[model samples]
Target: MKLYPIESGNFKLDGGAMFGVVPKPLWQRTNPADANNMIDIAARCLLIEDGDRLILIDTGMGNKQSEKFFGYYYLWGDHSIDKSLAAHGFHRDDITDVFMTHLHFDHCGGSVQWNKNRTGYEPAFKNAHFWSNADHWKWATEPNRRERASFLKENILPMEESGQLKFTGLPENHILENSALGFDIFFADGHTDKQMIPMIHYKGKTICFMADLLPTVGHLPMPFVMGYDTRPLLTLDEKELFLNKAADQELFLFLEHDAHNEIITVKHTEKGVRLKDTFTTQEIFN
Candidate 1:
């Protein structure tokens, strides 16, 4: 199996929102803020070429939103999914499965795009079976007031409407129980309801996709949780459990939202679970 890092693009978000209640002095040291106080974020996706299936985990924010809509996020970058795919001799059509960690716009917005006629939306990956669990599908479709803004209908409804959506049964624990997908899923609820974190076994190494549960190296601390999460207290407990296990097992963490650091590993320290080493995906995968 071969794994590729597909960088979609970068955008800016309020550092305060990203770091939650963590003080600016503390977070700014790692994720420095701009004059506007927004921190850089990447919509980095992962592509796995395993036999006949070319699985893509998370599609970054697409270019269908209006300028006014995008201005809020301050999107910036020259890289795109198409360019990144071409770098690896692949295209959207080559993807057989599009595994979404969650339905947030930054994570799954590129799953659909405007049709040629501009009359209706269509699945971006024409040949891919879009994956989302029943619980997350419902949570995103019928979003609560706090998360409603992040779950846009334009970015989501088209996948189900196109008849390409598939639902995976939630795992009883962190085990791959009858899951059609090749990877084991770690179901987390603190970030959002049933956000599936993929635990992929590749080349004698276990790589865990750190979605929103652990956005960046800055978020390694247990108290550093996102404010966007509905339940911050629950996030603390979940991070503690996941980080401890990651440190003990010596797993490589594939970060989805970290713009600068691509992959990282953690170690149990006197303070807590802290970052051990950083590497480009190629360093480990190659």
Candidate 2:
């Protein structure tokens, strides 16, 4: 199996929102903010090429939203899914599965796009089966007031409307091993309901797709949870458990939202689990 880090796009978000109650004085050291208090963010997706299946983990926020809508996020950078795919000698059509960690616009928005006529939305990857779990599908479709803004209908619904949506089985425990996508899925809830973190066994190491569970190295501290998370307390528990295990097992964390740090590993520090080392996808994959 081969894995490629797909650079979907980059944007800036309020550092305060990204780091929750954690004071700027602390988080700013690792994730320095600009004059506007915005921090650089990346929509880093993962592509898996295994035998006949080419599975994409997440497609960054697509370009279908209006300028006014995107103005809030302060989008940046020249990287795009198309350009990144081309660099790897592939295209969206070659993708057989699009496994989303969650339904947030920034994560799964690129799964659907405007049709040629611009009359309506259509599946971005014509040949790919969009993946989500039954629990998350329901939660996202019927979002609560707090998360309603992040779960946009335009970014979703089209996959099911196109008859290409598929659901992964929810595990009874924290993990579902040997999933249909050919990896173990670690179910996390603190960030959102049924947020599936893919634990992929590749190249003699476990490369975990750390979705919002651990956005950036700045979020390594125990209390550094996102304000967007509905259950911040639960997030603390989940992160402690996951990070401890990650440190013990020496898992290579494939960060999806960290614009600068691509892959990282943690080790047990006196202050608890802390960043041990960092690596680019090329360094680890090649």
Candidate 3:
């Protein structure tokens, strides 16, 4: 199996929102914000080549958003989703599966794109079977008020409209129980309803895609939850349990939103779980 780190681009998000109750004084050291209190974050995606399956996890924010919409996020960076995939000798159509961790614009916006003269939206990967669990699919499609702005119809509806959208069943039996994609869908509700965190069995280790659960290396601490989370108290409990298991099993967390760090390992310290070390996905196979 081969894994490629596909960097869609970088964008700015309010640091206060990213670091919940954690004061600016604490988060500023790790990710300094501008005068507007916006911090840069990487919308990194993952592409896995396992035999005949070419699976892509997340799509990052696409280019369809209006200038006014993008003015807030400030989508800066030269790397694009297509460019990053081409770096590994792949293309959009070459992807067989698009495993979306969630349907937030930054995570799955690139799943669709403009057809001709920006008339209609079309699945970005015409041949790929777009993957999302039934529960999460419903949650994202029928988003609540707090998350409605983040779940854009342009980023999602096209897949189902194109007849390429399929979902892994909810209440998945024993993880991979007839899942649409290959990996086990570990569900967590702290960030969003039934967010599917892929537990990929790759290269002799379990690599967990730390979606919003662990947005960045700085979010390793239990209290460093995102304000975007619907339930911050639940996030703390989930993080503690999740981090302890990660430390126990020595798993490499593949970070999606971390600007600088790609992957990291955690260790149980007297002061609670702390980052043990950092490494790239390429370093893991080596």
Top candidate on lDDT is 2
User: All candidates' lDDT scores?
Assistant: 0.92, 0.95, 0.87
lDDT of 3 by residue, 120-236 (tens): 999989899998878888888899999999999999999999999888877633245435666666677899987878888887898888889899988887889999999889788
lDDT string for model 1 (1-286, tens) is: 9999999889999999999999999999889999999999998899989999999999999888889988999988898999999999998999999999999999998998999999988999999999999999999999999999999998899999889999988776654543687888888899899998998899999988999999988999999999899889989988999999999999999999899999999999999999999999989889
Q: Point out the worst 10-residue segment of candidate 2 by lDDT.
A: 153-162
TM-scores for candidates 1 onward, in order = 0.98, 0.99, 0.96
Which stretches of model 2 miss by more than 4 angstroms?
none
Q: Model 2 lDDT vs. the true structure?
A: 0.95
Please give the clash total of every predicted structure, in order. 0, 0, 0
